[model samples]
Target: AARLRAAGEAAVARHLQGQVGRAHRVLMETPRMGRTEQFAEVVFAADQPEGQIVEAAITGVSGSQLVAG
Candidate 1:
Protein backbone atom coordinates (compact mmCIF):
# COMPACT_ATOMS: atom_id res chain seq x y z
CA ALA A 1 0.00 0.00 0.00
CA ALA A 2 2.81 2.39 0.82
CA ARG A 3 4.58 1.61 -2.50
CA LEU A 4 1.34 2.15 -4.42
CA ARG A 5 0.79 5.52 -2.69
CA ALA A 6 4.33 6.59 -3.49
CA ALA A 7 3.89 5.61 -7.13
CA GLY A 8 0.66 7.55 -7.35
CA GLU A 9 2.27 10.63 -5.83
CA ALA A 10 5.18 10.39 -8.26
CA ALA A 11 2.77 10.08 -11.18
CA VAL A 12 0.84 13.15 -10.01
CA ALA A 13 4.03 15.11 -9.62
CA ARG A 14 5.14 14.23 -13.15
CA HIS A 15 1.75 15.22 -14.55
CA LEU A 16 1.86 18.55 -12.73
CA GLN A 17 5.38 19.22 -13.96
CA GLY A 18 4.32 18.50 -17.55
CA GLN A 19 1.38 20.85 -17.19
CA VAL A 20 3.60 23.61 -15.83
CA GLY A 21 6.04 23.19 -18.71
CA ARG A 22 3.23 23.43 -21.26
CA ALA A 23 1.87 26.54 -19.56
CA HIS A 24 5.33 28.14 -19.60
CA ARG A 25 5.69 27.38 -23.30
CA VAL A 26 2.28 28.86 -24.07
CA LEU A 27 3.11 32.03 -22.12
CA MET A 28 6.39 32.40 -23.98
CA GLU A 29 4.81 31.86 -27.43
CA THR A 30 1.70 33.97 -26.85
CA PRO A 31 1.81 37.53 -28.16
CA ARG A 32 1.34 40.16 -25.48
CA MET A 33 -1.72 42.30 -26.33
CA GLY A 34 -3.10 44.87 -23.92
CA ARG A 35 -3.89 48.53 -23.59
CA THR A 36 -0.94 50.40 -22.05
CA GLU A 37 -1.35 53.42 -19.79
CA GLN A 38 -1.61 56.52 -21.99
CA PHE A 39 0.15 59.66 -20.83
CA ALA A 40 0.65 63.03 -22.47
CA GLU A 41 2.21 66.35 -21.58
CA VAL A 42 -0.75 68.60 -20.70
CA VAL A 43 -0.53 72.26 -21.58
CA PHE A 44 -2.85 74.74 -19.88
CA ALA A 45 -4.15 77.83 -21.66
CA ALA A 46 -3.04 81.23 -20.35
CA ASP A 47 -6.65 82.33 -19.90
CA GLN A 48 -7.51 79.27 -17.82
CA PRO A 49 -6.15 79.58 -14.30
CA GLU A 50 -7.46 76.28 -12.94
CA GLY A 51 -6.45 74.46 -16.12
CA GLN A 52 -8.26 71.09 -16.42
CA ILE A 53 -9.25 68.88 -13.53
CA VAL A 54 -10.60 65.38 -14.09
CA GLU A 55 -12.73 64.13 -11.26
CA ALA A 56 -13.47 60.44 -10.79
CA ALA A 57 -15.58 58.57 -8.27
CA ILE A 58 -12.51 56.83 -6.84
CA THR A 59 -10.55 60.08 -6.56
CA GLY A 60 -9.91 61.70 -3.18
CA VAL A 61 -9.24 65.30 -2.18
CA SER A 62 -6.63 66.40 0.35
CA GLY A 63 -7.43 69.86 1.69
CA SER A 64 -7.93 71.90 -1.52
CA GLN A 65 -5.81 69.69 -3.80
CA LEU A 66 -6.88 66.56 -5.64
CA VAL A 67 -4.88 63.41 -4.92
CA ALA A 68 -4.00 61.41 -8.06
CA GLY A 69 -3.00 57.78 -8.32
Candidate 2:
Protein backbone atom coordinates (compact mmCIF):
# COMPACT_ATOMS: atom_id res chain seq x y z
CA ALA A 1 0.00 0.00 0.00
CA ALA A 2 1.05 3.59 -0.47
CA ARG A 3 1.02 4.11 3.30
CA LEU A 4 3.34 1.18 3.89
CA ARG A 5 5.67 2.43 1.18
CA ALA A 6 5.84 5.81 2.84
CA ALA A 7 6.62 4.24 6.23
CA GLY A 8 9.27 2.04 4.66
CA GLU A 9 10.86 5.02 3.00
CA ALA A 10 10.80 6.89 6.29
CA ALA A 11 12.39 3.97 8.07
CA VAL A 12 15.14 3.84 5.48
CA ALA A 13 15.77 7.51 5.96
CA ARG A 14 15.89 7.03 9.71
CA HIS A 15 18.33 4.17 9.43
CA LEU A 16 20.59 6.08 7.10
CA GLN A 17 20.57 9.06 9.40
CA GLY A 18 20.86 6.90 12.50
CA GLN A 19 24.20 5.60 11.34
CA VAL A 20 25.43 9.01 10.38
CA GLY A 21 23.98 10.59 13.48
CA ARG A 22 25.83 8.20 15.76
CA ALA A 23 29.13 8.88 14.03
CA HIS A 24 28.59 12.59 13.80
CA ARG A 25 27.77 12.82 17.48
CA VAL A 26 31.03 11.11 18.34
CA LEU A 27 32.92 13.39 15.99
CA MET A 28 31.31 16.47 17.49
CA GLU A 29 31.80 15.13 21.02
CA THR A 30 28.09 15.14 21.75
CA PRO A 31 26.28 12.80 24.16
CA ARG A 32 22.67 12.76 22.99
CA MET A 33 21.03 10.74 20.23
CA GLY A 34 18.07 11.05 17.80
CA ARG A 35 17.24 11.97 14.21
CA THR A 36 19.40 14.89 13.33
CA GLU A 37 20.11 16.75 10.15
CA GLN A 38 21.98 19.49 12.01
CA PHE A 39 24.85 18.79 9.67
CA ALA A 40 22.57 18.40 6.71
CA GLU A 41 25.12 20.18 4.57
CA VAL A 42 27.78 17.64 5.45
CA VAL A 43 25.61 14.61 4.68
CA PHE A 44 24.30 16.01 1.41
CA ALA A 45 27.76 17.10 0.39
CA ALA A 46 29.66 14.10 1.73
CA ASP A 47 30.35 13.31 -1.91
CA GLN A 48 31.95 16.60 -2.73
CA PRO A 49 35.57 17.70 -2.48
CA GLU A 50 37.07 21.09 -1.95
CA GLY A 51 40.58 20.17 -3.02
CA GLN A 52 40.14 16.48 -3.60
CA ILE A 53 38.15 14.32 -6.01
CA VAL A 54 35.46 11.72 -5.41
CA GLU A 55 36.50 8.28 -6.60
CA ALA A 56 33.67 6.00 -5.54
CA ALA A 57 29.99 6.01 -4.68
CA ILE A 58 28.22 4.81 -1.52
CA THR A 59 24.53 4.09 -1.55
CA GLY A 60 22.45 4.51 1.60
CA VAL A 61 19.03 2.92 2.05
CA SER A 62 17.56 6.37 2.70
CA GLY A 63 18.09 7.27 -0.93
CA SER A 64 21.06 9.32 0.20
CA GLN A 65 24.01 8.88 -2.10
CA LEU A 66 27.61 9.20 -0.92
CA VAL A 67 30.91 9.39 -2.77
CA ALA A 68 34.36 8.54 -1.54
CA GLY A 69 37.68 9.93 -2.63
Candidate 3:
Protein backbone atom coordinates (compact mmCIF):
# COMPACT_ATOMS: atom_id res chain seq x y z
CA ALA A 1 0.00 0.00 0.00
CA ALA A 2 2.76 2.42 0.86
CA ARG A 3 4.55 1.70 -2.37
CA LEU A 4 1.37 2.19 -4.31
CA ARG A 5 0.80 5.56 -2.67
CA ALA A 6 4.33 6.63 -3.45
CA ALA A 7 3.93 5.57 -7.05
CA GLY A 8 0.70 7.49 -7.33
CA GLU A 9 2.31 10.63 -5.95
CA ALA A 10 5.22 10.26 -8.32
CA ALA A 11 2.86 9.89 -11.25
CA VAL A 12 1.05 13.06 -10.27
CA ALA A 13 4.35 14.90 -10.01
CA ARG A 14 5.38 13.75 -13.47
CA HIS A 15 2.06 14.79 -14.96
CA LEU A 16 2.30 18.26 -13.49
CA GLN A 17 5.89 18.67 -14.58
CA GLY A 18 5.03 17.59 -18.10
CA GLN A 19 2.13 20.06 -18.22
CA VAL A 20 4.29 23.03 -17.33
CA GLY A 21 4.26 25.81 -19.93
CA ARG A 22 1.68 23.89 -21.93
CA ALA A 23 -1.55 25.55 -23.00
CA HIS A 24 -4.94 23.95 -22.50
CA ARG A 25 -8.34 24.75 -23.83
CA VAL A 26 -11.10 25.68 -21.41
CA LEU A 27 -14.70 26.74 -21.80
CA MET A 28 -16.43 29.21 -19.51
CA GLU A 29 -19.75 30.90 -19.24
CA THR A 30 -20.68 34.33 -17.97
CA PRO A 31 -24.10 35.66 -17.11
CA ARG A 32 -25.04 38.62 -19.25
CA MET A 33 -28.37 40.14 -18.28
CA GLY A 34 -30.76 37.22 -18.47
CA ARG A 35 -28.68 35.15 -20.86
CA THR A 36 -25.49 33.19 -20.57
CA GLU A 37 -22.48 34.32 -22.57
CA GLN A 38 -20.41 31.29 -23.47
CA PHE A 39 -16.70 31.68 -23.96
CA ALA A 40 -16.34 28.93 -26.50
CA GLU A 41 -12.58 28.71 -26.50
CA VAL A 42 -10.20 29.88 -23.82
CA VAL A 43 -6.47 29.20 -23.85
CA PHE A 44 -5.20 28.53 -20.38
CA ALA A 45 -1.83 27.95 -18.77
CA ALA A 46 -0.74 27.05 -15.28
CA ASP A 47 1.65 29.51 -13.70
CA GLN A 48 1.83 28.34 -10.10
CA PRO A 49 1.35 25.55 -7.66
CA GLU A 50 -2.16 24.26 -6.95
CA GLY A 51 -2.75 24.56 -10.71
CA GLN A 52 -3.59 28.22 -10.55
CA ILE A 53 -4.64 29.73 -13.84
CA VAL A 54 -1.70 31.99 -14.60
CA GLU A 55 -2.59 32.99 -18.15
CA ALA A 56 -5.76 32.87 -20.20
CA ALA A 57 -6.84 34.18 -23.57
CA ILE A 58 -10.32 34.03 -25.00
CA THR A 59 -10.07 32.90 -28.60
CA GLY A 60 -13.75 32.92 -29.43
CA VAL A 61 -17.15 33.60 -28.03
CA SER A 62 -20.34 31.84 -29.05
CA GLY A 63 -22.23 34.66 -30.61
CA SER A 64 -25.39 35.52 -28.86
CA GLN A 65 -28.61 34.17 -30.32
CA LEU A 66 -29.49 37.66 -31.45
CA VAL A 67 -25.96 38.69 -32.37
CA ALA A 68 -23.73 37.66 -35.25
CA GLY A 69 -20.16 36.51 -35.01
| Residue pairs whose backbone atoms clash in candidate 2 | none
Q: State the lDDT of candidate 3 residue by residue for 1-69, as single tens digits.
A: 999998987775554344434444332233211111223222223222222222333223232221111
All candidates in order of lDDT, best leading: 2, 3, 1
| Tens-place lDDT digits, model 2, residues 22-55 | 3332111112112223432222333233333222
Ranking by TM-score: 3, 2, 1
Residue 9: error of model 2 in Å?
0.1
lDDT at 64, model 3: 21
Superior by TM-score: candidate 2 or candidate 3? 3
Index of the highest-TM-score prediction: 3
Q: Which stretches of candidate 1 lie over 4 Å from their true place?
A: 24-69
Q: Between candidates 2 and 3, which one is better according to lDDT?
A: 2
Report the lDDT tens digits of candidate 1 across residue range 1-69.
Answer: 999998987775554333321211111111221111222112212222232333222122233222222
Task: List the lowest-lDDT window of 10 residues for candidate 2.
Answer: 25-34
lDDT of 1 at 47: 23
Model 3 segments beyond 4 Å from truth? 27-69
